[model samples]
Target: MNPQHTRAFAKAAGRFSNTDRIDAVMLARFGALMTPQIRPIRSDIIRFANWSPPDER
Candidate 1:
Protein backbone atom coordinates (compact mmCIF):
# COMPACT_ATOMS: atom_id res chain seq x y z
CA MET A 1 0.00 0.00 0.00
CA ASN A 2 1.04 3.60 -0.58
CA PRO A 3 1.86 6.03 2.20
CA GLN A 4 -1.38 7.95 1.64
CA HIS A 5 -3.37 4.74 1.93
CA THR A 6 -1.45 3.70 5.00
CA ARG A 7 -2.16 7.07 6.57
CA ALA A 8 -5.83 6.85 5.70
CA PHE A 9 -6.09 3.34 7.13
CA ALA A 10 -4.36 4.49 10.28
CA LYS A 11 -6.73 7.44 10.57
CA ALA A 12 -9.73 5.15 10.16
CA ALA A 13 -8.39 2.69 12.69
CA GLY A 14 -7.73 5.51 15.11
CA ARG A 15 -11.40 6.49 15.12
CA PHE A 16 -12.46 3.22 16.68
CA SER A 17 -12.13 2.26 20.33
CA ASN A 18 -11.31 -1.43 20.46
CA THR A 19 -8.62 -4.00 21.01
CA ASP A 20 -6.30 -5.05 18.18
CA ARG A 21 -8.33 -8.18 17.47
CA ILE A 22 -11.60 -6.24 17.39
CA ASP A 23 -10.05 -3.55 15.22
CA ALA A 24 -8.80 -6.16 12.79
CA VAL A 25 -12.28 -7.65 12.63
CA MET A 26 -13.81 -4.22 12.06
CA LEU A 27 -11.33 -3.44 9.31
CA ALA A 28 -12.07 -6.72 7.63
CA ARG A 29 -15.81 -6.11 7.85
CA PHE A 30 -15.46 -2.56 6.56
CA GLY A 31 -13.32 -3.71 3.66
CA ALA A 32 -15.83 -6.40 2.80
CA LEU A 33 -18.77 -3.99 2.85
CA MET A 34 -17.25 -1.08 0.98
CA THR A 35 -16.87 -0.79 -2.76
CA PRO A 36 -13.31 0.00 -3.73
CA GLN A 37 -12.49 3.39 -5.18
CA ILE A 38 -10.02 3.86 -8.03
CA ARG A 39 -7.76 6.82 -7.36
CA PRO A 40 -5.21 8.20 -9.82
CA ILE A 41 -1.78 6.74 -9.14
CA ARG A 42 0.98 9.30 -9.55
CA SER A 43 4.60 8.44 -10.07
CA ASP A 44 7.24 10.20 -7.95
CA ILE A 45 7.98 12.61 -10.80
CA ILE A 46 4.32 13.52 -11.20
CA ARG A 47 3.92 13.89 -7.46
CA PHE A 48 6.90 16.21 -7.19
CA ALA A 49 5.77 18.20 -10.19
CA ASN A 50 2.41 18.76 -8.52
CA TRP A 51 4.00 20.01 -5.31
CA SER A 52 4.46 23.76 -5.01
CA PRO A 53 7.70 25.00 -3.53
CA PRO A 54 7.51 26.81 -0.18
CA ASP A 55 8.58 30.13 -1.67
CA GLU A 56 7.61 29.84 -5.33
CA ARG A 57 6.45 27.47 -8.03
Candidate 2:
Protein backbone atom coordinates (compact mmCIF):
# COMPACT_ATOMS: atom_id res chain seq x y z
CA MET A 1 0.00 0.00 0.00
CA ASN A 2 1.16 3.52 -0.67
CA PRO A 3 2.48 5.27 2.41
CA GLN A 4 1.39 8.68 1.19
CA HIS A 5 -1.89 8.85 3.10
CA THR A 6 -0.39 7.21 6.16
CA ARG A 7 2.32 9.85 6.23
CA ALA A 8 -0.27 12.52 5.71
CA PHE A 9 -2.29 11.16 8.61
CA ALA A 10 0.77 11.17 10.81
CA LYS A 11 1.44 14.78 9.92
CA ALA A 12 -2.16 15.66 10.62
CA ALA A 13 -1.88 13.97 14.01
CA GLY A 14 1.15 16.16 14.82
CA ARG A 15 3.42 13.12 15.08
CA PHE A 16 7.16 13.51 14.55
CA SER A 17 8.58 10.40 16.21
CA ASN A 18 8.89 8.38 12.98
CA THR A 19 9.45 5.11 14.84
CA ASP A 20 8.34 1.90 13.13
CA ARG A 21 6.00 0.87 15.96
CA ILE A 22 4.44 4.29 16.19
CA ASP A 23 4.04 4.42 12.43
CA ALA A 24 2.39 1.00 12.46
CA VAL A 25 -0.12 2.11 15.09
CA MET A 26 -0.78 5.35 13.27
CA LEU A 27 -1.32 3.49 9.99
CA ALA A 28 -3.74 1.08 11.67
CA ARG A 29 -5.74 3.97 13.10
CA PHE A 30 -5.73 5.73 9.76
CA GLY A 31 -6.91 2.58 7.98
CA ALA A 32 -9.67 1.93 10.48
CA LEU A 33 -10.94 5.49 10.79
CA MET A 34 -10.47 7.04 7.35
CA THR A 35 -10.72 3.91 5.13
CA PRO A 36 -9.13 5.89 2.29
CA GLN A 37 -10.22 5.05 -1.20
CA ILE A 38 -8.34 2.67 -3.41
CA ARG A 39 -7.03 4.81 -6.29
CA PRO A 40 -6.58 3.17 -9.72
CA ILE A 41 -9.73 1.12 -9.16
CA ARG A 42 -11.61 4.34 -8.39
CA SER A 43 -10.35 5.85 -11.65
CA ASP A 44 -12.02 3.07 -13.61
CA ILE A 45 -15.29 3.63 -11.76
CA ILE A 46 -15.08 7.39 -12.37
CA ARG A 47 -14.43 6.87 -16.06
CA PHE A 48 -17.45 4.60 -16.41
CA ALA A 49 -19.63 6.93 -14.38
CA ASN A 50 -18.61 9.90 -16.49
CA TRP A 51 -19.34 8.01 -19.70
CA SER A 52 -22.72 6.79 -18.55
CA PRO A 53 -25.94 8.58 -19.53
CA PRO A 54 -27.38 10.91 -16.93
CA ASP A 55 -30.31 8.59 -16.16
CA GLU A 56 -28.02 5.58 -15.85
CA ARG A 57 -25.65 7.51 -13.70
Estimate TM-scores for all models. Answer: 0.36, 0.54
Residue 49 alpha-carbon offset, candidate 1, angstroms:
18
How well does model 2 score by local distance difference test?
0.79
Which window of 10 residues has the lowest lDDT sum in candidate 1? 1-10
> RMSDs, each prediction?
8.6, 10.2
- Model 1: colliding residue pairs: none
Q: What's model 2's lDDT at 8?
A: 79
Which lDDT tens digits does candidate 1 get at residues 1-57?
Answer: 243554466567664544787656656655665535657766987888899868764
Best by lDDT: 2
lDDT value, residue 29 of candidate 1: 57
Model 1: what TM-score?
0.36
Report the Cα lDDT for candidate 1.
0.61
Give the Å error, residue 12, model 1. Answer: 13
